[model samples]
Target: MYHKKMKSKVVRITCIGLSILTLAFVSILIYSFYGSKKTIQPDALLHQYMANINDGKYEEMYTLLSEQSQAIVSQEDFILKNQKIYEGIEGKNLTIKITKIDELGKTQILVSYDTYMDTLAGDISFSNEAYFTKNDNKEYRLLWQPQLIFPMLNPDDKVRVNTLKAERGDILDRNGEVIVGKGIASSIGLVPGKMSDSKELDIARVSELLDIPVDHINKALNATYVKDDTFVPLKKIPKDQQELEEALLEVPGIKISDIAVRVYPFGEKTSHLTGYIQNINAEELKKLKEQNYNANSIIGKSGLEKIFEDRIRAIDGYEIIVVDSSGEKKETLAKMSPKDGETLKLTIDAQIQSVLYDQFREDKSCSVAINPKTGEVLALVSTPTFDSNDFVLGMSTDKWNVLNADTNKPLFNRFKVALCPGSCFKPIIGAIGLTTEVIKPSDNYESSGLSWQKDGSWGEYKVTTLKEYGDQVNLQNALVYSDNIYFAKAALNIGGDLLAEQLTNIGFQETIPFELGMYPSSFSNTGTFDTEIQLADSGYGQAQILINPLHMASIYSAFVNDGNMIKPYLIYKESTVPEYWKEQVFTKEAAQIVRNDLIQVIENGTGSDAKIDSLTLAGKTGTAEIKQSKDDHEGTELGWFSLFTVDEHTENPILVITMVEDVKERGGSHYVIQKVKTVFEKR
Candidate 1:
């Protein structure tokens, strides 16, 4: 029995031993397959690191670092360092492309990657290598260092950024004369040691003269860095304010130094043309983001300064570099050279503009002067002008409000706008009548005192003239007498369709092709005359006709240019050539007939007051009434005078159109004619 039990025990032990071996073999196979999988590829580890960076998961990236790297940099320090450097340059769109994974041995790798990112300086791209190793747990890990962020980064290295300011451009006139140019402004300041016995009194006097506050001056003088010898600046005044400067110089302790400033030589005279510049606002920055404009940028506010902003503005440059502890540049990472703004030359005569402005200062008026022979614009002036320099030098809120609230509309730009042309449009009607042969130059008509109409169909409306001359009047005689009845009859005979067609062909109800914004001339609010009464009134320049003064100047040129109208241009280029706005707008015969009559109108008619001494001048006078109805006798009136020198009596061949509002009580068209005469006499 003992022998049999021993045999059974041996068999049992052998079977149990075999089962243990089978389980051990299966466990070995499973461990071998998973352990190999746990060892991450070098490229795969690099891709994961980059993905964490792209997601801004810097903590995860720190965990991917090798044990030696973790000891070198803490998780908090690593995250903060990466955050500061990347955000310092406004970096975005980070990408890392693993180009190659080199295996140094079984546990280490040298992975090369191409890094790219966009920043404020533009785009940055560079190639670098990432060192990686397997940790004790057999997982791949990065051997991190500061140099991993930037290939050139070292322990003491620093990223430096700087800006190169772009210089502003100048505004030049036709003769290369500086209009808006660089000049000096008096930097008003005081030396603490040089102050007189009455230091407080002197400072107070300066404050008043500069239109500055006493508190501001006191704060500047009391600044922490101020010394007895330091000249702490308080304010900047225009250099040309001689009287004010002299008064301030009389006060003790005041020291005036010259500082560079933007100058408008003509001051209030050219304010409407040059406009001004100011610091960019939040709304403007939002709209100009794609153009790289920032909060510190300066922008043109109005007029030509605003119109050609891109051409006139400076393009700033930038530099990204590495610097040492002492702030010395070690290497230039990226740099862009500054591009100075381009100077723009205009077809403007400074003298002419100044003279025209002087004449209209007291009155609400506007004028435009053009060189009829070359199509070059000479002058544009508006009355009650404000100083553009005030905008740059900083205007007080009270002063700005005064200008904004003025009844004369000093801020309004009237030169490029449309207004009633009055009798100044008579010559155009006569020219068109002769061109289409709708009315003959010699055709005579009978005048009916001061008022007349087509028939009973005209209802309460009647055509009226200031005066009648003879029983029978020819076209020239009617034009000379300023007869509205004669032209009204002619318009009735021509019919509305043909007259409207003729007006449209003459460039009416269309925008003038010019650089500046010119409101188009229109026949009426709805762009058409609804009745014969409306049509007749339009023919005599009294209905709903509104023409831009610039367009009017261009149109009148046709009468003198052998039926060709000169194209008005503002910008002056070296290769400029004279061009025509309209060729053959009238037959030579038609243009000549109207031209001769205009000369007569100046010589003996309503325009006689505008004739300059020793000059062969031709002109027309217009007084357009703004009334509710034809029978309404009381309303405001706009006075106009269109004049041109027919001969070389002046240095330049000039054509001017001057208009003044509220001339009804004043001499009507005669008032505007006198203003033109004064402007011409000044030349």
Candidate 2:
């Protein structure tokens, strides 16, 4: 009985231990099952997916989409769509922030997020909703929806982007008349593909009709990438030439096509001021690519047209269009309207510019007129100018080569650069002498047509006058006669450093604030006067000095405006403030004295030919000798005439300056003087 009782107790203990171990194992198994089955939060999945998209990881973004969405749109298509939208944007970034989350069902969640991107227009902001569903695999996936790509997109519609360019602005004159704008012209050419296979037949026919060499046509046809269908422009034909069009059409593959081209109604009259436009070159296109310029873009090549290019260029618009599979436009999704460029009004008087330009019909010369008080450039003309229309409408290679090879250099802007001022520089020196206390109006210097300093200080320092004066000459008579001896001796008294300071004070070697930049006029101001002869020569506008017509005219305006130099300008803007250097280069009294001397020039001195009837005029004449070389003492002459007269209507002094180069066959300064008078008489 005792043995049986002990065995029963052991059995009871073993059963209790096995029961405890079983309970522990079952608890662990239950915890593992619940942890593995927990659903992923919809908010977390949506945030991660948006983050991938913003990082430009479109491929990763595609992987997070539900199986339903991936079936319709492939990862490659999604990437391409994103790339097209971001192509032209400079620095692109997309910001997404979750604002709210709505629970639709036990496994579906809708997330609302704010989308933001900065664009040229401004900050572009919008709200979008992404739907997420817990898939059978127990992980949340983004449901493919129309709003997933863009807030306004639809499932069946295609996204298309169209670039719309604004119409380029019109360049207008002071009177608001269009000076440069769009117009139609004819381009004569043969479609390379349409031409006959026999080179001889096609080349001969084209050369005969266009007056081009057969060899030239053959060369052009054989150029690299000369496809058969490409239109190779042979020449620009006149739009009115219907007969020439018919004649050209008779040739196989030869045709006339109308193309939009820049038109300049005034043509050569405004060539220098308005400039011209041409197709962008490789180098220019590269530099302008960031500005949306392309290979086919027409850009300003010279003058103000180039200077104000950015302001005159139109803004480009864009459209989001939906197209069918065949690439046919089906519907417009969104559009941003294009804006035309603003109208640029200039300070130029077209009528006056036209009249002045015609006056120098065949002469190679330059003339500039300005309003002294207002600083308005009324007229600027560089004669022997080529018609801008030739470039705008297009020219043959033969005509272009001839113009460039011509010795006359009609393409050069003579008004921006030229030789010395000649006697027209007298007033500048006279003013310098009086202001520096070097000489007085009352002080008389000996002028017997020639003066020589025998002192060994200046080797071969001799001065001569335009004409013989009496034994003595004062400031008045020196200017009236333009006596070189009187002015030279006066310049020697001030020395080089002081004279240079005065020249700098009066706008010499300074940057003039004009759109069409001016070449800096140089002076012999190295702070070293090697010989008195150099100073003496400079006093008469000879020696090492170079001046442009624009700068010379601007300096003379100071004389007319009581020693104030106003900045010259071309464009007119209401917001543009007037700019001027007001330091007293010369006193009011000295300016009046110079004015009287100038008037005496027209009345009794070298510029007498410029005297106009019933017009009170103050003027000066100058003739400068340009040495053929350092050793060639006999030089060509450059004639100059500067005049200022008060306008009858405005009561402001109107200053006109004319310069003629290589005047060997001309009438000297008198020729320029008459040109000025002719311009004034028209007024």
Candidate 3:
């Protein structure tokens, strides 16, 4: 009986143990199942969302979302946002492949699709990848924002937030006053796609309202809107009159958008330095697209604008609007706030620039002022200038043609393009003679009003003499009298190649690399000659050698700053990129010697016309020959003058270079000198 009881107990205990083991296994399985169900898988959501999108069931794809997601987004927004994608994939077979599944439960879907547009034809195709996430409810939805796919398209929903459109950074003078400002303008815009019936649109009404000819409006409308479905501007109407209001009311198809027009209050006075901005054209748009730039944006056309474009252009903000199948906005989904560009503080002094402009207006000439000590350009003035405001508002074709046709070439920046350095080249020769030891302070050559060739082939070239020095004149007197013979002798001693090399080192033969584009002036060697004729001509600033007025001014600056070769700069500071401002170039001694000699020229030589009372001035004058093919006055010379003045305290010297083309009508050097004197007198 005892043995039977023990066996029963053992059997019962074994049964209990097996039962416990089975229960533990079942519990583990239940826990695992629930845990997996609770976890949200973004990849699953992405797959489902992509599948729905491919099927054109935007509402179904949008509904599979968490409460937070649903509250933030709407069905109409989803449809509108995906409309562009659908359009892009229209008429082409699309293959959606899941490329990457990450630990965040997000899946990247690669969409291979083709598109057709007026600009792009022949079934253009490209592959784009997007990411999506799965919610806890086991629903998959797109995780990537719509902007990633259709960057140019509007968002589906409007974000309800007070957001400011950041303004582009101000262009300020050294004093921190705004050179370019925002103002309200009468803007005429047209929705090429929106205008259904061209007959219903009153071209006459638009012309009357905008104060333009009816024919002009009709032509623009036909050219821009007749064949394309896009927004095109007929013109930016000037708000100087009240007709804009009357036009907006009468023109049903015309829309007036508040546009921020850039204004230069100082007008033409700052035109050369500040440059101008204009609407992007088709060519510009194509280039911008290649550069990954916004199609509808303004860009710098010249001067500082071109130099600091990256720093001054603001990051454009975006609005998300949901659109429908027909490409109509339903609602806004999200928005990105724009950031303003950094302000640029230019080294330009408006006051000085104004003074220089007025000074050059007396004659059809241009001048450039550079800070010899630092290579900073103070003022660049090109006279006979047009209002830069014309460029800001998009100049009329008539005005552009007139400016282009003007004999003075008012559109040309004379300081950068026109070259006539004449006697101004003498200083460079002097420097070369001094540096090469070809002519010492003690060395003297006879200036009998002429220097003759050793071969006696060419008759002696006449040189003006202040005094008869018995066939011997020192460097001081040679410079003072502007003696061609003395310089010729010096040039022969130094050799033409060496002279060219020296002149090049002091800023000649190449374009002055300022913030503006410059034309490279010519420099040629006096064909390997045994005589000093070519050298003498080059020494007196003539012959095949040429240089721009701005370059001449910079070379003079090198003289004033004591031999420091500094690269001319216009921009002082940019908030966006600080690295550009850190560049330093120039030496002080080299600039000073040149400066001292220039001062002596103003005080005692040909540049005496430039002297101002109480100011220690230095200058040189040149009458450069212009070949006949250049203009009507082929034989007439261009007057050139460059000078720098030491203020009363002698702390900072101001350098200026002026070039007057075809100045023979006004007495060449004599006339130019008087103009320089007038400027100094005003100072």
Candidate 4:
């Protein structure tokens, strides 16, 4: 019985021991399961907050931390400081994922997370291992060891984004060929905050690599600052080789990014028409914001680009990434693809444009060639033009200064800016005289080289002429010879008020409303002129009359092609109708009489120089006096000749107009007519 009792006691003790062991195992299993189930622990949450802070998601990341953390860092302080850090991360994809959690004593936790980061500028992709420490209650958190962290958050990450870039739009010839588009150009970027620790960044070494001066690298490194534990750069990295290399020495921190540059292959050839784009400065930004534009972009400084900026700017896209304490990306939560700008096709013929550019290279001249029937501009040329490409990739400060200070004003689009109609105004006046019945087509007048006053006091109204031909000269002979007296007589008969009214009816004295602004040529209204001299001078295409080459071209188009004044247009078609205009302005018959007379001028008058062998052309020439100062008899003549071809075989007419300003030696209009002859012969 005693042995049996002792054995029973031993068995009970063994059972108790087994139960204790099983209970301990079960408790451990439960703890392990809870720990492995991804529970939101204080330390885990603190790590996430630190990651958020590093990634620049301060508010949400802050929320994840315990109340103690919030007390330690106020929302305002956190925002202000993290904004600097966040700026560094802008345009970068950063994400983090928790990989492990380790308890450190009773009050601290070490959390490890995996990170992935990408920078679009350098096409760089990086993966890193990171860790952060959190208090037991997840209240306060900090980077466990910043130096040991492979992917330390850079302070300059923010300032790098703020650096100015010259964003450019594509350049297309009138035919829609890509003359200039987005091109990749190598650039260097510096993270000021990243390089704040100058010891880690060897300026000389970097300068050697990038071919920049050591001083430059040192300057940039010194410019870095920390705000809310985030580093911000002070300046952009130098594009110089030494500077770029020195910046790269910091590797993942002092980054080198690529910039999109504007390119114009045609160079100076299409400069005037296409214009140029430039980076937006602070002042420009203010204006852009007022105009509802994106502040972080470039805008057309002049030419067609400025006129059509809305159609060419690319819509910005964004990506949402989750980052970790080590400033590495964990995942991409969402992405919005960028929308490319619309491609614009122009009506400008590159070949014709090149030809026209060459023609005016030696002189201060402007020309406008358009399809009279459609008002499609074929070639618009202005001399002393600059390469639109110079405006791209940030023109050197020296180059910019020279261009801006040039006396000739190469930047000005002389075709639209300088008004000098000269003899070109005659055809329009003739058309007015014919249409308004101010003078009959068969009306006759006599000229003795000059029109005189009844007193013959030297006629105070001597107009330079080619000498009188006969006693009775009709409109045909007068037009052929550009007889100043004949037109003067006609002007007297028609009256200045009536002439001005008629000219305005045909689209003069008003802004030539095209896609671009046209400089209005000066004009005046005079009724039945009592002064014979005023009437004669007006007849000879002088006396306060001025018009743009483009305007002159459009008006002349009306004269030749059945008199229907087609509104001059730039864009052939648009997806949507433009919002700022309406109505057409001139009659077909009115244009025909003018066209016939103009054709006769080309056939036999001063414009005879423009005659072509194969194409029957009609045109007129004018050399008007340019008034400089009172008592200073310095006469600078403006020459003009406009014509349209009468294709005998095709029965299709093509219009061309050429204007040359301030011709000192040969008659300006006469000189231009010779040029027209060359153009026609070539065509």
TM-score of each: 0.84, 0.77, 0.67, 0.67
Which candidate achieves the best TM-score against the true structure?
1
Stretches of model 1 off by over 4 angstroms after superposition: 1-94, 104-108, 117-123, 133-143, 186-236, 240-260, 574-576, 631-634, 648-651
What is candidate 4's lDDT per residue for 1-683, written digit by digit as tens? 99999999999999999999999999999978765555466445545654665556767855654455467667776567556534543434555666667776765566656655443222223434433344454343543222212344333222223222333456576667776676655555554445455544445555555445666656655654533334323223223446445546455445555555666667677788778787777887876664434555667878787888888765555554545656567555334455566667776767777777777777677888876666777778888778876567545555677888987777767788646465566666666776776666677766656544424754343555565768667776777777766676677777766766666665555777788787876564432344556555666677656677777777666654555564667765543222222122334555665667767787777787777666778877777677763244776777777777755354434577777767758766777776766665665
lDDT of 2 by residue, 453-571 (tens): 63676655456565776765888888888887777877888788898888878767777678788777767656445566777788888887677777777777777677767678887
lDDT of 3 by residue, 1-683 (tens): 99999999999999999999999988889878875555435545545655665567777866754455566667676667566445432323333454554444243233333222211111322344444454454444554455434433334422222233556677888777777766666678665555546544566666555555667766776773365554556666446646656646455556666667877877787786677887677887786754424455777778777677788876665544446556666655345567787788877777778887876774567888766656667788888888877887767666788999998877777766747577677777776676666766667665555434545555544333234545557766666666666766677787877866666666555656666787766666433433455555666666566777766665555554445455677778543221221121223432345456667777887777667777888787777777644244548778877767754356545677788777877777777777666655664
Question: Residue-wise lDDT of candidate 1 within 38-68, one digit each (tens)?
Answer: 5677788888887777677888888889999
Better-scoring candidate (TM-score), 1 or 3: 1
Worst ten-residue run, lDDT, model 3? 576-585
| lDDT-based ranking | 1, 2, 3, 4
Candidate 1 overall Cα lDDT vs. reference?
A: 0.84
The TM-score between candidate 2 and the true structure equals 0.77
Query: For candidate 2, what is the lDDT?
Result: 0.76
